[model samples]
Target: MSKLDKTNEHEEHTPSSSFSREIEKEPGGADIQHCIQCGMCTASCMVASVTEKYRPRKLIQKILLGMREEVLTSELPWLCMTCRQCEERCQEDVSLAEIFHAVRNIAAREGYIPVGVQKVVDTVMEDGWMLKDGYSDFIEDDRDDLGLHTDLGWNNEFVKKIKKRFIDGGNKK
Candidate 1:
């Protein structure tokens, strides 16, 4: 109610920054300024539903506020499923999934990737799949039980080309 209290309230709020504006200059990243903090994206996020830590709404706010290191170093950006459910329901039509991807790209470039993500990349690069290379003894029995072919679908040649495209191409996927 007092003048001093009003001024303190204004000072408590940090200013938005040009980081998001810079990102907006890139393709598919122009909607950063349109976020209204409505929490719709958070509510609709499949990851957010399960994890209290991976809120895209809060991440966008941090980006607009220029908390670059915090957002870049955290595992939050990698957690996005890119399902587009948040974008579909957003009132401002902000490309939430794209924004997340942009942040992830930035983080990855800076060598801030989480260990789990690195493992996934390594697995795909080495085997063209998420699981470990080579088949298990039980796998054949399971396939037979389901009346399926015994082919484990490990195409070494195709995997080699994929590895060259992604790993040898400066991580281009």
Candidate 2:
């Protein structure tokens, strides 16, 4: 038998099928099967433009070949800026951004989130906001300074009720 046929026969009985099954469980994975191996994505990627090692084409190839560990652990997965440039440039409209998002979620589920991303997640969880510098402290100009009436029937009671509802609903972090 030919080498290709022998390899296929060997893979049929191997644990590699489990990795294939896991990849199938990913949402939109069916789209991956339709990839034509065009290098447009890698050509248009800004990261790939600057970095010799960060090519989306190589990523697609690895995923197609079921290189689970390499695809998941590579810095290339986290290097995506989510710019959608690759998606926009794709002739197949393959949703590369969605694929990257799936990869990131898988990495996170496997407890592989990089320290920088984990710090951002932790800050958001703690502050209920993504700003690392905390809320801006701009002082509101007084009504007198703006030459307007200070008491224009603004209802403090209504504002208080809204604040109480938000706090009770666990949204007041």
lDDT winner: 1
Error of 1 at 152 (Å): 11
Off by over 4 Å in 1: 1-15, 133-173
Could you tell me the C-alpha RMSD of candidate 2 in Å?
10.8
Worst 10 residues of 2 by lDDT: 7-16
TM of each candidate vs. truth: 0.69, 0.63
Leading candidate by TM-score: 1
List of clashing residue pairs for candidate 2? none
Each prediction's Cα lDDT score? 0.76, 0.65
Model 2 vs. true fold: TM: 0.63
